[model samples]
Target: MTSTPEPWGPVEPLEPALSVRRVLTLERVLAGEPEVVAGAAQLDRPVRWVHVAEAADVGVMLTGGEMVLTTGVLLAGDENAQAEYIRSLHRAEAAAVVLGLGRAFPTTPDVMRRAAERCGLPMVVLHRPFPFAELTEEVQSRLVRRKFAAVSLSEAVRTALTGLITAGAPLQRLLDEIAHHTGCPVVVTNLAHRVLATAGERPAVDDVLRDWERIARQAGGSEGDGWIRAELGGRGERWGQIMLCGYRGDTAGGRLLADRAAEALVLHRMLGGTSAHTWEEQSAQSLLTDLVSGVVPARQLLPRARAAGLPVNRRTFVPLVVRDGDPAQLERMLRLLGLPGLVAEFAEGAVAVLLSLARDQDADALAAHFATRLRTESGESRTVVAAADPRIVWDDVPTGLREAQHVADAVADSSAALDLPAVVRLRDVHLRGLIRLLRDDPHVQSFAERELDGLLCAGAGDDLLAVLRTYLASGRNKSRTAQLHHVSRPALYRRLEAIEARLGVDLDDFEQAASVHIALLAHDAQQA
Candidate 1:
């Protein structure tokens, strides 16, 4: 059976001392409100009469918006205590003070006015006796209204979320809606710590994720899942954090709401492809892609990075190709380095590092340590290479990437023969020799076309072509190809038909196609 929603709680009555007008006045206050002491400036502003037992102890008793009412009995003998009392009231953000015209404070002293004026605390006096009962009733009405307003706001949130769900809203749209309703900037990051959606001063919060990583770690871990509320500035000061815990309320109602929102966001992301990426792997792959003509420099990308606070100087730097098992593994290795001045792009299943090394000796040590750490983590028996200091300009990442990939490829290819981990430099390899061989062999060019050209030409749907290349490369063995492609035996046969139709090649007749494959490889070698 479905349970009914919880009804709004009954409104609580305000304190008898305060009047309705005064509590209402607080809602309009921003900064620098006037200070009126005693009944001198009755017409100046609205006042709430918050009675205090001890005039001297008003500071501790004053919260954000109370107007202190006292008989001044505590200021009987000490001027310093009197001055301190007024100052405390001001500092505690009291709306105003009312001095009852009787007892020890029968007359408003000049010191009281000066202190109140100096500290900016308003002072008021009741000209004639007023009933506390009538004041309390009025104040209670205002309090009830305010409570209802809060409930209305909560209901609005529910309505907005329902509208979004019905309208099939995107994550970005949802975040924008939430920010609009909350009257605060909002940022939503995925489990992988990448910002998914943001509203309100997004550009200002570009470095938020990076900075928040440390904050999150201190909170617990990078994947810390909870709503954290903290005051923005000082204690009880302006801009304080009003975070909800556990992505919801610390306890009941808010918790369920926040949890539901989080789940909806997750589902939205799954449909929208806003999933967090594995940085290290993505970085390496991007670097390699840039080098191997896998991707072109996009104008849209760097602007997005800048918006996220990754201020890439894009001037003089070295492109360090950092390879490891994965992003988590690379992060661990980086921490183990125990050195400073290292920033990395963890993208495309690879780690492309940028290091600011003052000492040449330190550079060498960084490379060696990174390589050793990589080997330990990779477990793939691969030797990862860290590039030599190459002057990489913003536009030159592609060229630098090419150099990085060439060096790494040479290392990887040589690993088996040399029984050494591959960490070769591109310039160190005999590019001229490879080029000359390709130039002399015309058949190699044709072979590459017959074998690999179709893979590139298929546009986005090239997986079938890819299977064909691997199948052919493995010497036409169905079992080996099936294992490499991660397909069942029957699926392998189906993939072969798709591949053959797309490539227009007869894989069954390998003898005739061998010549064409050789020619295409020759062309690639020349380009290398």
Candidate 2:
């Protein structure tokens, strides 16, 4: 037995066209019995206007996307001229060509029809006598009406978004309004490409964010069906972008919605005195400061961190301290790397960043990468110091931060006189770093004073002290020290002999030289 055929589903309605289509049922033109002789498949091309041109070079007089009304008066016998006329209109991007019949060969010219077919330019012929004035008036009026409707729609969207902003609606509410108007997913992101807010059906939002890294990479060019973004901010200070995902509308309409939403969000943030970006940074800074101070236990601070959108329980934490780098640039870089972290201005001339690492990631490698990026971005004047604890527990983060801070402080103190690596760590600073940490103690201060008292009180300036520092720092190599101080060999020897005599120590003795070196490091640390 044969199965019954299934009933067909209802057809979905077509979206409204931005401009009048060439195949639009023009009642006056159709009453004259027009025949579409070529490019029937392209009859739906948009026509911005209707123009009458009897010249052979009419294409020069027209802009793109217009339907030309002609009578073939100039090319009634010449086939090449007919072909060239059709080719010119095609090059000018004319929507369609309408020819009035009974005066030019009583039918469409074979050369013009073939040319239109080759160029995919729709060609229509009126079989009966038709007035070009009537058709032009009808099409022009329709085009004007459509243009007005589009302007009205844009104004309506702007008013709605403005009202929402004036009412003090939150960011999510504003995004939701945009989504409602566009019937698509709306997203807001900072310059770093972190998703700040989203509004749409849950599944649609998830689909957009599922491959966010790829999407972010492609966001530099907004020429696709996936997403379109409108920049936010003014006066050359671009703070973020508003994106419309899966917007199934004309590009003009989608852009209108995105621009209105972006404007509303910017105004909302300005009126509220704090943006979502600023608030998030402030929250992270507060949490990090509290963690470093050890005023609250790690377990107790977990809830606050989670509320601030930090992933704490299953992540590896690396504490980093950067000297002479901008905190804002660091935050932007972190967002670009898709690494969530807390960044803030710590002490004067120092920025602290607490990086959240995934389970499989290496903290040291990431720290090195971050340091290289910082150097490349901010130049060699900046230094980055990091501490990576093998134990990835939250309880250890406070200690790690202190360690990193100490390393950074020591590196900054010594960077002026010594050439150090870009990425500094605890091992790089060694004994001098340890001594700097204890420089404030009474015993350490006393030792440093006793070891260098003679030089300190010799009525001579820091010249001899400078000589001793270079001498000790160069591993007691006289020639190397002379090269560093830009002095002759005899002058360097005399300076070294004077230093040894005043300090009451033998320069040839390794133990005595080591003691003096330690004393000098302690004094420098205390001074710093």
Candidate 3:
């Protein structure tokens, strides 16, 4: 599925809390002509607050993320004190330290510089006398504004996503909302890096996923250039991650968007009471449902199928529909058997599955194995897997799916009582299949109505209809029909005679009996 159309103009990317790099650019700090003395590479580190202190143990009164400003007066006389001071700042995770020089020391000190360099704490020196309060006031105000903006953005996104979840919007719609806010492609993946869903500007999203395998392999550790990732899980179990692909916003803001999206997804799953596997099934459901319904052309859906981790290129497609089988269980079984396939439930209660297999693989054997294994696993001997002829072209899958569904429908009734093959093919259903295929034909309907009209009348009340069903399904064997219906032979004979008399037919005549049975099958198939 495609992303929801963008309804508004471009959203300005989020700004992170003031960074030391940003701090250095301020007019107040720039007035002193600041020079980077040490740890110049980490300029982008966030500065939560600005502090001015000359006490060596000033790091004790501080929390992390503070940019400490000092005059170096207390640090100049003692080398150990200077080194300890830098170490303390590093341990406290201070953002950076700026040393202003005048009476404290006319220039940057080698001892303090060496300590800051060793500890990897950003150290800056003022070349001219400058008021520290000016820089502090400017940076703190900016930090407060950025923090406010971040909180407002977070709350806005959370509210939007919550509304979508409450409205019963699916996962794709939620991702679309996230992409709309971030102006970036949103990607959701399982632990193995299988892409389950994606949304964003179509071209940008396609570009991000064009080389997804390589990108996924290289993506590790913390945030990359706009690539913000958040864990998608709850209760101490992380099943996957949600990522903003090529998010060019500030890291903290990208983080906020990713985090809000992740929270919404987790809460959505919890409220919907579905597992990760169920979400995967839903994705498959959307894709397969579209394919079978033919609402969207197959060529347009190729990209989605490929992005969903299905190997679609140059493969054989085996379409199989199982009667009354669980989609989740079928998908798991496919994985256990080391096959690549997509499983989704059809509108008519049958689970439709499409297997992607290599050209040289034995498709029939694997399909049979899947059906047999599913039967064994579910302990359901009556499960019918109606198989359609494998198609080599992707465009032909819709027809194959319809054929599979039709065959499955054909077997839905007789499979339980009759000994149906584990993997029921089109030819296996024979007359039953033809009846189902022709159930909607006007002539077939008229013929069925004409032949079975007596039993279908309002006065019949389904008594003789039930007897006829059992007698016909038992292949005209009266004794077996009597035993199955839990009635004696004389009682079954009387019912059969009543059925024959009401329909103006002879049960002993093979041709008449076969016609009535076919009409009954056609009627039942039509009703189904």
Per-model lDDT = 0.49, 0.77, 0.86
Q: What is the TM-score of each candidate against the true structure?
A: 0.46, 0.53, 0.73
Candidate 3 regions exceeding 4 Å error are 1-13, 57-63, 75-93, 110-121, 208-210, 215-220, 294-315, 332-338, 358-360, 373-382, 392-396, 410-420, 427-528
Candidate 2 deviant stretches above 4 angstroms: 1-15, 18-22, 26-35, 40-44, 222-226, 273-276, 279-355, 358-528
Worst 10 residues of 2 by lDDT: 4-13
Residue-by-residue lDDT tens digits, candidate 1, 386-479: 4645553445555555556445444433312343434445445454224333444556555566566655577743576456556655667899
Cα lDDT tens digits, model 3, 101-195, are: 88878988888899889888999999999998888888888878877787877877777788778777778888887898787899888887777
lDDT of 2 by residue, 1-528 (tens): 333222122222223552434334768877888888998888767777788987888889889988899999988998888999999999899989988887676977889999999999988888889889988888777667767766776676667667766666656677777787777888777776666667787567766766566677788885568477899897789887889997887666677668877887888888878776674565566677888889878666664555345667689988888887677899988887788788887677777888888889987787778888877777665455555353488888888887777888888767345556656777778897798678889999999999999798887638999988878777788898899889999998888888888989997999998988888899998887
User: What CA root-mean-square deviation does each model show from the true structure?
Assistant: 12.1, 18.2, 6.4
Best by TM-score: 3
Two-way TM-score contest, 1 vs 2, winner: 2
* lDDT value, residue 322 of candidate 3: 92
What C-alpha lDDT does candidate 1 achieve relative to the native structure? Answer: 0.49
**Cα displacement (Å) at residue 433, model 1:** 13
Per-structure clash totals for the candidates? 49, 0, 0
